[model samples]
Target: MSDDLTKAGCCAGTAREATDHPYEDRARGVPPADAVTQADLRTRLTEIPGGIFEMGTRKSTYPDDLDSPVRKVKLDPFLISPTTVTNAEYARFVEATGYRTVAEAEGWSVVFHLLLPDAAAHPHHPPGLPWWRRVEGAFWAAPEGPGSHWRDRADHPVTQVAWYDALAYCTWAGLRLPTEAEWERAARGGLARKKFPWGNRLEPEGRHAMNVWQGDFPRHNTADDGFVGTAPVDAYQSNGYGLYNTTGNVWEWVADRYGPRPAPGRLPERNPTGPCDGLQRIQRGGSFLCHVSYCDRYHVHSRTRNDPDSSTSNAGLRVAADL
Candidate 1:
């Protein structure tokens, strides 16, 4: 991407205009298009006040593909769930609708190699990233394979859910995905634009604040954060607005399609929603697989994209509702 576009956006993941990014392909999710309406779905939500703040990072330790342009933005008051949707919550939806996620329909999803109890593979991994293994029958219900379920991690955020799957849940639960601007705003947790949700310092006085890769990437994971995979949805201290884990655990889906930020010299934004259209959708927050040595998107304000139909073990959902 050009310096102009890079200066217009922020995040560890970048969607170049002409780049052959994997996410550009058609989404593969199989959730029905119709939104479900039945139960009164409610969650522990944090009320965010209206304010002005920088939306992107001015500087980052990780390479940004020119997506870290710091820009001023204004937002209206809103309410956001403090934590992501948990497995127990998602199970309720499945039980109600007999929902078959994209992964279930596809019969396979990407699973991190280290998470598996033993070697099980068909060997279709992402180019340049071989640690991702395509395992059959890997869906939200069976995160690791037929043997794994959410019983142990019931309180943890649900994973192996595609963007379409998340929207379906939001519709059924009487919620909606937050826009990119709103996500960044809530992620800041009332702080001015900083590297992370908590503050500028990654570990305030040398303690792992959230679940992220503590050791090497794709190889040796010390798991010093007291987790080998997803942690409880409400693991750490709440942010200024009472939100948790805005920077780590799993990438949260947002409402907007992926596109470049407004070019330089544009007016300061008010509820900015990115470009008119694009191939991919926005994924805010980083995931368990992220590390400074490889993927440093663990920093708040960083953004990424994926096919709306694709699901992976590391990707999950954080729902938002209209208040």
Candidate 2:
């Protein structure tokens, strides 16, 4: 184990032995996380006066990407969280209801490669990238790997949560997950046809502005962005619209369902939800796992999807509401 893991209690069994459920045979799906109590939620609403913005990517950008089918969208004013949900905020939900996260309850959660130590020492682990481990006892509270708690990461985004879990939190908070369109609009930070929330340049200068993979990827992270794993919520500057960490840190769940076919070239100008139903839900804002060599979905218009019931160490949520 690495020194950080030791300090973070990665090898400790105190939290691990607390697991009452059996491992190996645990069902494959989101086991409930701490439930939301009536009081844990705080609501803030913003009315985005209706307007038209050029939706999707332009030809100059990564037009080949599915999410970049540039089109116009009209949206009604709505209120959304100024920042992604934090660990401190999520802790309130857990403390109030005694909710056990899927990873904690099941005894394992998938962790990224760079987050783990060398695989030869931890031989029972999966292969390929030793970083993506089914870490025993990993959860939102202990995001780095098993036994690592969220005490220092309280202000960081709450990860290792599923779409359903996000929905549950949204319900408790009297907010909802933003539709894919709404999410993209807010991520753009009111900048029309911009490649990123900040502007056309990925890094305005030689400086690293967002928390993304900086080195060889999977194997090495230079932490030039000042983050190895997740950064504090306010670690970086906010986008033009005052949204923090909107482009990186963790992938956020959106309310829209994934469509096998691209959305119609001509979409409703106003507040369009996604397809009626699909196998997966949309996820946006590429995670800390993103790198230029692999999984560069960090661009504002980029998107990916996964099973709604699935939860990974890199997944989290932000809340939105109707105006």
lDDT of 2 at 291: 81
Model 2 TM-score, 2 decimals:
0.81
Cα RMSD (Å) between model 1 and the true structure?
6.1
> Residue by residue across 1-323, what tens digits does model 2's lDDT show?
11112111111111122222232123222233333532234334444456778776654233333665577888887766767889998887667556565556556656665576643434333334345555666678887565578887888899888666677666545567898888888888888877788887878887676788888867788888888888877767777777877787888889987774445566555678878965567888887778878667788887777655556667788888776
Model 2 global lDDT (CA atoms, 0 to 1): 0.67
Clashing pairs in 1: 6-66, 9-67, 10-67, 11-302, 11-303, 28-309, 29-309
Q: By lDDT, who's the top model here? A: 1
Per model, state how many residue pairs clash.
7, 9
CA lDDT of each candidate? 0.72, 0.67
**Per-residue lDDT of candidate 1, residues 166-274 (tens digit):** 8777756667778888888888887875678778898988988888888877777899999878899889887888888998898898888876576544666787777
Runs of candidate 1 exceeding 4 Å displacement = 1-40, 60-66, 120-122, 264-267
* Superposed Cα deviation of residue 46, candidate 2 (Å): 4.3
- Give the 10-residue window scoring lowest on summed lDDT in candidate 1: 2-11
